[model samples]
Target chain A: MLKVNDINVYYGNIHAIKGVSFEVNEGEIVTLIGANGAGKSTILKTISGLLRSTTGSIEFLGHNISNTPPHKIVSQSLAHVPEGRRIFLQMTVQENLEMGAFTQDGSKLRQDLDDVYKQFPRLNERQRQIAGTLSGGEQQMLAIGRALMSHPKLLMLDEPSMGLAPILVEQIFDIIKALRDNGTTILLVEQNAQMALSIADRAYVLETGKIILSGTGQDLIQSDEIRKAYLGG
Target chain B: MVFLSYLISGISLGSVYAMIALGYTMVYGIAKMLNFAHGDVIMVGGYVSLIAMTSWGLPVWAAVVVAMVACTVLGVVIEGLAYRPLRSAPSLAVLITAIGVSYFLQNSAQLIFSPNPKSYPVIINGSLSLFGGKLTISYISLVTFLVCVIIMIALTLFTSRSKMGKAMRAVSEDKGAAQLMGINVNRTISMTFAIGSALAAVAGVFLCSSYTTLMPTTGSMPGIKAFTAAVFGGIGSIPGAFLGGLLLGIIEAMAKAYISTNISNAIVFAVLIVVLLVRPAGLLGKYVPEKV
Candidate 1:
């Protein structure tokens, strides 16, 4: 479970996330759907300790990780698959997986590798191939598989479907659903509200750094305002 | 026979440059910043080794170890104190800070050692005479060549296989993503400088030994050339550093022998400019297309 309360983040003088608050219960695919510049990525970054919240706090599985460093926050079983699938392009798929286990010794690394490979067999096939050469779908798979390498309690995914073909996007969404079914709590941020809401257990609609609406997946999908605004009628 | 001798000498000088250039390239690959102070760390290593041998009355082996440990500490300290704060600053700010560190080390050495040129001790003495003494190879040159080769092989393995090595490569490509994957970016960078500085100690020893003169500014010229070698061979490639160093060394030797010794340095740099114009990425470096 993760709890974010009234967190405000800034980039120099520009206010980014302004007093935004949200939560994700255990075993829920909690989706944050918003347009560009809605501070979705910034909120995820702040939770992962890549950027600091100027006020308020973030709690993850009982730890007040508000001020923890990014690297340390990772060891706490919270893996963030950053926006744009930032896999180490020069590295092999296997090497990228190994990097996900960076905060750990090799005790469970072999097993974790097996788990990731099982999840994304395309990644296993291209284990030794350079990651940058992977197809958009495979790269997205690599990114998710890499996050799973840490055996994370909470997996935060940002724009997992960005720059992918429609079919690949469906495949990625299916993978996300499968991951949640396997009992990994996912906090997914997406501009693809229709697909996200279809799979999400609960959802929040964000606009201009504020949460404008919250409901169960089906409620938001069928909501008139949501269909008009996010779902494009 | 004359050509062979110059070639042998050239290889020896090239080996030394390769060692120094390794430090330069390794730091660049990981930290994505040029630590101009890297060469000065080598100067400090030379001083430490010289003092350990001449003043502390230590054996050659002990002195070498002392110098390496001292330089390692110095490297880590420099990264922590000088470069760490500028992590988020612009690259130009980091470059200026690196130059500042270089000057700081040089002036500190000048004040401590009085800026006088001192004779470097002969660590590897004697020579091998071959082809009926037509080709004479110094023991130090052989050692330098072997050491350079070993370092190259070891570094290749390190970057490719080891966890820390993997972390370095990851950080080099993308720092933010590396952090997301739980790699300690700061610690990885510090380790890079530490390894680089330790190698600088060895390079300093070999450089001062052949050049035969140790001074506060001794590392500056060789440092520049080795930096040139890194760029010549491709700044981030390990093999590139070795090849660049060797080529630069050979060119310097050939120029000094056949061309004007006074203009040998100029010739080496001129070659670099021409090479850059032809291949901006250096001999082994990849041309990274500009991302708009």
Candidate 2:
């Protein structure tokens, strides 16, 4: 559903992502696991068109969206839940969700909001509460819920599990699995390689802005290098 | 009696400033750009209304409607041409561009409209007495005050209840995330400029009607005052700007009555310095954490 090909991202002459490439087929959960400063988030940002790549291209469902404006990317069925829970702090939980479905038409918007509400009933309970006041776990759910409002075919989450408790992390992984089961392709970037590998169909390990390892999740988990380097086994 | 008269007039003037200040708050809240040309937009709006009513021979209502439409279009154009390209530029660059736009608009007005002030033909001629001999408010003042209050109510409802307003708030909070949610950041920013410029138009007309004079440079003082109001109220908070406007207006009037007109601005700024020293975020603004 999405392909990022040999993209080079520069932040004022610093090559953040050096020729990184990856793909996610429809309905698959593909994760990029790396340590801090490994450029996992930059790759996700480039795919979403938030950052322009000096070289290489991004294709979404067979269309070149590499240079497309960030706003237009969502219309093409790609939504990005950024690194932090960057929820509109002043807005209510319901308002955040409404903002997510900003591109949808009347009936589809209503249905989408309902679907998101169903996925996270806790959001429905706190519909009128300000998002900033919500707990870290709740804000994470709202962030994911807001992205789901776009009804995207592929959702790119940058470290959704970051700062979340281990128990909450497990539940979040379950939600990721459920989302994939329901036909939504996902590109998840995570520091928790073990948890991500458990749910991912395929996985890639990044180092210094380059993809260093690739395998099926279970296979990578069983690999000696992956176990030692990422899984902390 | 004289004191009460000045107070009433000050309230009327303050109301108009509050109306225009909302525009500043709205655009600044979302874009974090001051829209320095906003004041000049108000001046152009006055001329637009003047030409419509005088040269085009339209009725007062028709002229107001035309002026508002024209200014809204002008605002959208300015945002497109001046702001859209520099959306991601550094905050300093945006501020400089805004001042550039401000000067550009003021000079353009000078070229098209005469430099000398022109009087707005009387639309309301009567005055009503209140508080026995203490107060007498002009029909124009009453009308301007009522209109400002109405616009404030409408704006409050729009931000709180309307979907587009919520989209605006969302964009102001996080443009990148807002784009990811399918909210058109550019469009929303354009709309904020449009709405803000439109309200400034209304203020222009009221200001001209109240003072009976319009000039190319008319926007400067009010623009500064409105900017002060925005800062006083807390830059991004709507109600804060409104209260700031009213407070500044009242203080200025009281100073003119008891002290002198020369020191009114100085007093206001001094107040601002003191207020900001105590609450750096202004009255309604809260300190937000920076992104890591």
Candidate 3:
């Protein structure tokens, strides 16, 4: 489980995340849904150790990782797939996945590679192809597959469906659900509220750097305020 | 026959420059720093190997090893002390700091070794007869070319096949994402510096041995040329550095022989400008669009 308590993040003079707090329980899919600049990605970045929190703390499985470097935090079994699918463009698909397993010894590396390939068959087909040449959807799959290579305890995905087609988005959501069912905890950040809330066990609605609503996914999806604000009802 | 001889000698000189250029390209690719002090590392390597041979009475092979080790350590120390702290600083600031380091190395060498040039003992002696002894290639030139080729092949294999190599490529692509993958970015950068500096040391030994002279500023001319070669080959591309160094050396040799010795440097830069104008990304470099 991951616990975030009152973390504030800033970009020089601008306050980006204001006292945002959330928790992701084990074996569940938790989602943060909001419009642009809602501090969802900032929260994830802070937890992943890419950015520091000016106030409060983040605890991953009872360990305080607020001050840890990003690489060290990853060794603790937390994987973050940043927004924009930051896969190594020049490297081959297999190489990118290998990079994802950077913390692991060669022992389970082959098994891990097989597991990732099984999840994304397209990646297996293009294992030797350069990542930048892949389609947007494939790149997203590659990003997810790369993150899964680390065998993370908790996986954080930022805007995995941002540029994806509706059909591909559904497929990605199904994959997320399957991953949770298979015992991986997921913290998803999304702009697609309807799709996110449909799969997430619990959901938080963020607006302008603050969490405005929190409830079970179904409740939020059915709530009049969320429906009007995010569901386009 | 004369032209062929000049071409052979050019290749030998180019091999040395290519070795130094590889160091520049690799460091620039991963660390995003020009490492102006890199040339100075070559100078230091020359000094280290000279002292090891003359003062410490070490064999040529042992001296080369000592030079390599010394340069590697110095590189790591330079990264730790000078470049690491400026990781987040602007590129201009890092560039200035690198210049400062370069000057420091050169000045330190001058203070220690004095400004006068010293004779460098021959490490590789003898020559190979070509076309019935009418044309002969020195053993050192052939050895330098052979060593450069071997190192290039080895480096290519290491970067493509190793886990650390994957981490390095990842870091170069995206530092934040690379960390998310659990790569120690700082450690990768340090390793890059170490490898690059060690290569520079190899080049330094070969250069000093061939020229038979050593000076504190000896590394500057080749350093600038190798830097130019890196840029000409497409700054971050490995093969680009190799081709660039070789081509630059060949061009310089041809110009000195045919065009006039005094204007060879000018002609090298002129070729760089023309090639860059034609292909902004350098010979083997790909144009990468900046990500938002």
**Number of colliding residue pairs in model 3:** 0
On residues A128-189, what C-alpha lDDT tens digit does candidate 1 reach at each position? 99998999899999999988888888999999989999999999999988888888999999
Interface RMSD of each: 0.7, 1.0, 0.7
Per-residue lDDT of candidate 2, residues B222-292 (tens digit)? 89888988898888888887888877788787887788888888887888889889988888877787755
Supply the TM-score of chain A against the true chain A for every candidate structure.
0.98, 0.97, 0.98
TM-score of 2: 0.95
Q: Compute the lDDT of residue B136 as modeled in candidate 1.
A: 90
Tens digits of per-residue lDDT, candidate 2, A1-77, equal: 78888899999989889898888898789999989999998998888888999888888999999999888889888
Considering the true interface contacts (CA pairs under 8 Å between chains A and B), give the fraction that model 3 also has: 0.96
lDDT of 3: 0.93
User: Which lDDT tens digits does candidate 3 get at residues A7-31?
Assistant: 9999998899989888999999999
Measured on C-alpha atoms, candidate 1 has an lDDT of: 0.93
What is the C-alpha local distance difference test score of each model? 0.93, 0.87, 0.93
| Clashing pairs for predicted structure model 2, backbone only | B233-B240
Docking class for model 3 is high
- Which stretches of model 2 miss by more than 4 angstroms? A108-110, B1-3, B131-134, B289-292
